[model samples]
Target: MIKSMTGYGCGARDNHKVKYTVEIKSLNSKFLELTLRLPKAFSDKELTLRSECTRLIERGKVNITVTVEYVDQTAAAATINTELLKNYFRQLEAVANELGTNRGNLFELALNMPEVISHNEEEADEEEAALLLNAFQEAVAQLNEFRKDEGVVLKQDLSTRTQDILRLLTEVEAVETDRIPLIRDRISQYMDETVGKENVDMNRFEQELIFYIDKLDITEEKVRLRSHCNYFLQALDAADANGKKLGFISQEMGREINTLGSKANHAGIQQIVIRMKEELEKIKEQLLNVL
Candidate 1:
């Protein structure tokens, strides 16, 4: 069955020292477009993680995000500069005194200044890196399962619509049977009005009418359209992803339906052709999301 490109999955794992959470999201696209968001500490493992993700997912616009939290806040907290804090306080205190404002709470203001706080971003050690990769692989597996479930629903919808077009083809054949006599009678009447009925040769008129009707025959179009519809259904049963293959088959189906419509001069057959086109348009729209 075909899998859908739209899905989401999440996974988390925690060591005694830190907790790691991984999330995966995807949407439909013609090619793979991947983006990763990670904490500064784990920047070195980005390329390895990216390669793994590419091997797992073949298509879609994908995003992977990782978050981490230390078990002990005091061990991983930001460091403050005492001298920068003191310098900021002195300048701010002088300005406040000149304005005659209250001098209290100056220390609170200085603590929040830009240069007063700084934290060194560290590199991910071997243990932490392994934990994150394990969590990420679990997330990718869950996302693939989500896609398989959605694929079953898509297969059902597409099969139903293709059957509908087949039913409509039967209707076109029924309406076509009664059309030739009407065309022949209209042409005979026109000849009577212009050249007089007694002056016309019946044998020659019948021969020309047969040749003209042959040009309007749609037998070949109907045969080709039915074949294309069957091929579309077969592609859905394949184990591998066949989204691009299905798209090409549908284009061929459209060409046959259009030919049918052009050869059908009767109003009833033309209307049936329009309905078939409607079903085909819907199939194309749904194929955009298939994987």
Candidate 2:
């Protein structure tokens, strides 16, 4: 089945100490391009996260944002250096005495001094990392589901367009019979005008006309175009990533359509070819987002 390259998903997990939230967004791209936004403590695991994303997402421009919010009061509590605070207060009091000023708000001044309150940098914890990984997996699952849903709609649109092209091809076939006779009549008229009808060698002219009409025959193009369209539908039903393969098939189909257009000497057949080309272009545009 086909899958689209654009989607969005979010997953969150909360524990006693921390809450982990993971959000991922994807857009169509020819290759896998990933951007990560995570806490400094988890910076070392960026490569692992990228590898996981690559394994899950075949091709797209992906962005991941991880948020770690501390829920426990103790997790973010700052430690006070009581001895340093006491020393600063004593010094400030002495200074105040020398200046003959009251030591108002001395404790507050001491508490604001450098080194009095400090927060220890948090380290990477294996258990917390595991929790984050779980959230990431959930987010990926949601994204895949989103892609699948979009793929269903895309599949329907593509199928309809392909069938439309096939219908137009049939119309081309309906008017094909007139082309040969028209060409022969035009050639005969030209010969009669250039050289008198009596001087024209009828047998040789007939043989040459047969050869010329054969050259302009679009029999092979119509057959190959039908085959290409069938192959495109088959690829859509396959259970693998066939975006590139579908693109190649569309190119082949375009070739046949172009050849048919060029060889179609009748105005009606040319109009049908134009419609087929329009439908084929729509298919190509949609294929860019398929995987």
- Provide the overall lDDT of each model, using Cα atoms, as 2-decimal numbers: 0.88, 0.89
lDDT of 1 at 117: 85
Work out the TM-score per prediction: 0.83, 0.86
Worst-scoring 10-residue span by lDDT in model 2: 118-127
Q: Candidate 1 local accuracy as lDDT?
A: 0.88
Residues 56-148, candidate 1, lDDT per residue (tens digit)?
878889999998878756647788999999999999999999999988988899999887987643556778888898999889988999988
lDDT, residue 173, candidate 2: 85
All candidates: CA RMSD in angstroms?
Answer: 3.2, 4.6
Which runs of model 2 end up more than 4 angstroms from their true locations? 78-122
Model 1 poorest 10 in a row by lDDT: 118-127
Best by lDDT: 2
Residue 29's lDDT within candidate 1 is 91
